[model samples]
Target: MTRILPLLLLILTALAAAQTVEQEQQPIPAEPEIAEASAEEVLDIPPGDISPLAGVDLTAPGDITVMDHPDDSGDRLIVSFSPGSEAEYADLFAAYIIYRRPAGGSDEEWTNVGVMPVGEGTQFVDGYDPDFPVNIGESYEYRVSALYLDETEVMGEPVIAQEVASGQWFHQGKVRVLVACLIFLGLIFYFFSRARMGATMYLRPIAGIEAIDEAIGRATEMGKPILYVPGLSDISDVATIASLTILGRVARKVAEYQTSLIVPNRDPIVYTVAEEAVKQAYLEAGRPDSYDPNSVFFLTQSQFAFVAGVNGIMMREKPATNFYLGMFWAESLILAETGSLSGAIQIAGTDAVTQLPFFITTCDYTLIGEELYAASAYLSREPMQMGSIKGLDSCKAILMVFITAGALMSIMDLLAGTQTLSWLKNIVTTQIVD
Candidate 1:
């Protein structure tokens, strides 16, 4: 077997050598020379017919229609044309260039407005050009030309629009937005009416709000003052307003429990509002004389300085219960840590997302996000407040359902390649300009 293998190898080596020799002996072919032609020869046009319109289709685009653009702010005109001569001379047609002039204007006034590459789209909007926007309520005439690739064009007859561009009273595209808004308003009214009739609208319990009474009671038992910080924001802030509303409720409870209350402020305006709210709460609780004018006082306008002052109060007074509510900033941790170290049962609430982590870690119960805003309504449970909260929640639930459905459809369309739910996706993503 070894001897036969050597014989086969020798035959294969001889065959490879012979093929290499034959390939080396063959001659390589030369590349053909290409002669450059003149412009006339390349274009297939006679030298004498060297005009700009040479050998180009002179048939104009037909069925030119011009009108005021719909659903716009009265500054646009739409011009469209049919492929009459375009179909016959489709090979030479490169683009459709449009021109416009004032109505009844002469040929000298024809201005080159825009150029559209053929087959892209058959429509042109005149006022889309920022440099030469059409004036509203002005009449204009349009002319379209079929441009050929040979730097030549055939101009079409002019067409005048019957109606001048004008703004409409309502935008047609925002109908969906209008309908959604109307539905929300109707929900608000329905819930409002039901609430007025003493209907029991259920709301999920908030941990921070439920713990308020417990905290107040603990402070009363320990005979320690309750510290309430209405945040460090000004009076105009929504969080500050919500804090004030909550302050009224908290102060009334404090008044009823006959416990000492301390509210330190950074803004003088907030201090004024807080004082009034506390006094009114005392009046409401039938302990008007128990409301101390010095309880809700302005400490300082500086940020860190106010924190230092509040921390001092926490250390000295050793308040049994601490309430940190409103729009807190960088000072949130400083205040909450101080209260925690003082061994106070702390409850914090704020819409400030960045400060939530510190409060959650330090306080006993923390009202998260919208809970701070909903605190007043939850505590008061007034008919109007309950109704509005219920209506808002219902709208949110509906939106969540829509979002979930859209997400599912999007996933299905992506995986299965059906795209059957594209209409729903478009509706979900549509921008309504009102």
Candidate 2:
């Protein structure tokens, strides 16, 4: 036993030594991306002589730990952080903390939690409500930043905090919404998996999506650029994600048709990710050489500014095909109307029930609410995504029947509704169980 123990100890020692050597040999990661200073220093906020932080080191944002707030009592998450910026350890005397959403969400707007005073460490707390009463499955996140704004403008590593499940409420009909959302996302992953295994998905007739090839071809024929607006929102929203997914498909057809594709984005991070998606699409089409980094451009963060920029691009380039895929706001009409005037064939798809009418009037092809979510089913011919769509359809059908039956029973004062409805309603509403 002693002999075997010695041999085991030797093996453990060797593994530890090997790991240590590998870690030391591995180069330290370049600079960490700080939400305050930015990975690209796009903010250009010069470091000031704000004063040295006492005891804490704010040189890099990563030196601090933020709470995960995993408890699921369905409450708002407020995380407080202290700066660890040390004068000797940090580059700048002046310190400030800033943050942004990693995926460029509207809620990700940088908010200054607090300013660091010289000789004192900086501290800040975030109060974020994940709409606990409305969205049970939704996740809320943000990156906390520590800024060392000296003359050189060095940044601390950004600390990210994710709220754990907080017993959020589901959609109005919990079971139905749960099943449908599951089937939708499940299909996306499943179909992509099947595609990886060389299985083809049977994509159905999606009018708007089907016209992508025609639009790209028309743009090529017209010698004008193709405009791809992947929605103004960040990636958190399902609609925005659907738009981005469609963008990959649209970009592929555009690449194959050799048409100029111009993507203008309102969010900086969206611009970055969209660029990657476009580049990948082009690569998939074996036309990586045609992929232009500048094709995916950043407009302004302002809504109108983004509109004006995209409008100008559309009017000037006169793209024969404009693909509007994303969640939109009041700017929807302006873009759609302008594209209509430009004689561009607009293929618009959004989950906004309010704007569906405008798309119908101005767009040649338009996708309705769930249809936007059904895009993977439309584009990829993978059986799983198709099956998911079928599953969701089945779920929605069940929901409609249940809802109808319940309504009819309530109206007719059926026995079930008469005797049990009131009690169940009262119990659920008042959190009482008698």
Candidate 3:
């Protein structure tokens, strides 16, 4: 009986130890109370709204008015208010909030349109939201409220105004540009009318133009073709147009002298125009049978490739006269040098300032900047063109006189410390209207 008692006691003690181990191995229960405390600490809310500018008195802005922004689209509203008495109190108020409501709308329907910082100018331009644009030709009530740092605001008395946006056919600001354009056109027309009425206009002789006949005659006598490069640019270029004009005159002379004429072009459009121009010239010169469709041909558009092709032509054909008229760039020297090497008499004209020196160095004759623009008018000698040129010259002369007088007056004003010519200076320099 005693041995059985001892084994029973051992078995009980082992069971108790096993139970203690099991309890220690189990997960502890999560405390909901601790989680609640942590959340409260992280996101604690204030008990009530309080003003940062509490205890400070601020005066409200008065006489708030709204009007249409003059000379502008109707989307803009110009808001103005009487300067607040607390202008010196920078910290008393945070900003002025502009509020607006449609006419007859309730105070609750007023929307916060814009905000201006404290100490800002009394005027504000409210360019409304593009997505919800303000209705044009509709009345609206506006108010300005001074906002405090503590989320408190003092509203001003509201005012009602409406504006309709309309556009003018002519902008008032561009009046000066319009007047200048009209005067220039009027002068051109006046000169053209006089030219048609038998007025004789004289143009200074351009040596490059004078040598055209001699160049064509030399080509005729030498029995060699005359090469004409109308430039490397497209027909859209004014220089190219001038080149084509000169080409017409040169083609007529070529037809009259019965000399072979060759024109190599870089642009396809210019090639086409040159061909028609040459054909018309031949027809006008009573030598339509001499017009050859193959005379003007399109060369490669690549600058250097065109230069190479022209140089090859110059070498192979050894043309007696080479006319480089139009726009040229880096390849100007290449063409001029090749023509010179081929023993050809070259007459080059271009508005490209950089290429002028190259042509002048290698060619027999060269036309400078404005000379290219005047070439067509000078060559044609039509009454309208002559008269227009004369008008332009007269304008230039008047401008020169004004410039000289202004300079003299400026010097006198500086030396004498007087504003005697100040009005004249302002009249000359200032635009008619801004």
lDDT of every predicted structure (CA atoms): 0.89, 0.69, 0.83
Model 1 residue 227 lDDT score: 98
Worst 10 residues of 2 by lDDT: 425-434
Write one digit per residue (lDDT tens) for candidate 1, span 188-228.
89999999999998889998999999999999999999999
What TM-score number comes out for model 3? 0.61
Give RMSD (Å) of candidate 2 vs. truth: 23.5
Output the worst ten-in-a-row residue range by lDDT, candidate 1: 48-57
Per-residue error at 91 for model 3, in Å?
Answer: 22
Off by over 4 Å in 1: 1-180, 427-434
Best by lDDT: 1
TM-score of each: 0.60, 0.54, 0.61
Stretches of candidate 2 exceeding 4 Å from the true structure: 1-204, 414-434
Candidate 1 lDDT score at position 71 = 87
Give the alpha carbon lDDT tens digit for every residue of 1-434 in model 3. 86899799999999999989888566877866744333223234244534434575556787867777665556677878885634655555568888888888997989887888876877877765664357667677888888755446877878875453333445666665676577777888898889888987778899987888899999999999999999999999999999999999999989999999999999999999999999999999999999888899999999999999999999999999999999999999999999999999999999999999999999999988878878788888888778878878777776687778888998998999887767767646776644
Ranking by TM-score: 3, 1, 2
Predicted structure 1, TM vs. truth: 0.60
Model 2 over residues 1-434: C-alpha lDDT tens digits? Answer: 85899799999999999988888466877998766654224334445423333344334444444443333344434445554444465445445454534333465444444454555544433334232221333444444444444333445544455443354343233554456568667755764565567664454587776777777888888888888898888878878888888888888888888888899998887888889889999999999999988899888999998999899888878888888888988889899999999999898988888888988889999988888888866786556667667656656676676566656655666644454465433322343211
